[model samples]
Target chain A: MKARVTVTLKSGVLDPQGQAIAGSLKSLGFANVGLVRQGKTFDLTLDETDPERARAAVADMCEKLLANTVIENYAIEITA
Target chain B: MKARVTVTLKSGVLDPQGQAIAGSLKSLGFANVGLVRQGKTFDLTLDETDPERARAAVADMCEKLLANTVIENYAIEITA
Candidate 1:
């Protein structure tokens, strides 16, 4: 199965990187840009064949290696 | 309107960061992990109301700021 893991900063957290990007966009003439939040995306091809197990494994990967749970949240999507 | 921009490296490009992550995962006992690729995700809220215009604007942003056309590809998804 193919799995996607997205790790994003939680609400109420300060994202300086995202703020910098937003500011750069505004200066570059992207006037309508607002509230930009930057995150990480990972695509993994797992040996697991079952969607349920693949999701679980990916979620475990997130908790252990992909995300900092104190400030970030992760979502996993599985595709056959 | 809300938009998501995901920027990923082209297949033939080298991704040292992803390779490092995959190696770490394997060391941490994630044996099933394979073919990992890392990408960036940006969530943006635009003042524009039309979805089509929002997507176009986001795509332009990708070309100018978010992605490197020489080695990366970007996908824009608009959600109302």
Candidate 2:
């Protein structure tokens, strides 16, 4: 099975890295760029075959380690 | 308009960060985890309204700055 997890900062949270990227973009001539928020993606190859079990397991992983729920949000996708 | 860019390491590329995360997961009791690869997601709010133009511009950004084409691939999605 394969699972994908996307972890993004919650709205209203300050993202210094994103801001820096935006500034760089402007300097690089992409002045039309607005807010740029950076996040993370995790691609996982799992041994579990069952789709339901895989999703549940990956969801647990997201909650436990893949994401910091206080200031970040996560979305999971699983494929068998 | 909003655009999303997902940047991932190409196959066969060494990802030390992903390896470290996998190690942490194993220590955290996720023994079932297999190959774990980490990537990046960029959420961009663009002033451009035309979907085609937004996609093109973001693609250029990815090619030039958001991703290293030598060892990474990027996918772009634009939403109006």
Candidate 3:
């Protein structure tokens, strides 16, 4: 099975990387750009075939290592 | 309009960060892990209301800044 985990900063946390990107865009003459938030995406191929078990394992991975729960949030997407 | 951009390294590229993650998972006793790849995700709020225009602008941003077309690929997903 294939699973995708996305880790994003919480709303209240400051994202300097996103701000830098936005500023660079503004300098590049992109006036339509507004708030930019950046995150991490992990694509994992697991030996597990069961979608339910895969989701659970991926969720556990996110909690244990992939994400910092205090400042970030994680979502797991699983495909068979 | 809100758009999400996901940037990922092309297959066959060496991803040290991903390797480190995978190694860490293995050290943590996750034997089911196969291959792991890491990517970047951007949540962009645009001033443009039209979805088509938003996607085009986002694509431009990706090509010009967000992604290195040489070794990386970016996907623009527009919602709303």
Please compute DockQ, using alpha carbons, for every candidate against the native two-chain complex.
0.92, 0.91, 0.94
Candidate 1 stretches with Cα past 4 Å from truth are none
The runs of at least 3 residues in candidate 2 whose Cα sits more than 4 Å from the true structure, single-residue gaps closed, are none
Candidate 2 per-residue lDDT over residues A1-80, each given as its tens digit: 88999999999999999999999999999989999999999999888889998888888888889999999999998877
Q: On residues B1-80, what C-alpha lDDT tens digit does candidate 2 reach at each position?
A: 99999999999999999998889888888888999999999999999979999999998998879999999999998888
- Ordered from best to worst DockQ, the candidate numbers read 3, 1, 2
Each candidate's lDDT (Cα)? 0.93, 0.94, 0.94
Write out the backbone clash pairs for model 2: none
Write the residue-wise lDDT of candidate 1 on B1-80 in tens digits.
89999999999899999999999999999999998999999999999999988988898899999999899999999998
Model 1 lDDT per residue over A6-66, tens place:
8999999999999999999999999999999999999998999889988888988998999
lDDT of 1 at A65: 94
Question: How far out, in Å, is residue A48 in model 3?
Answer: 0.3
Docking class of 2: high
TM-score for chain A of every candidate model?
A: 0.96, 0.96, 0.97
Is candidate 1 or 2 superior in TM-score?
1
Q: Runs in model 3 with CA error above 4 Å?
A: none
TM-score of chain B of 3: 0.96
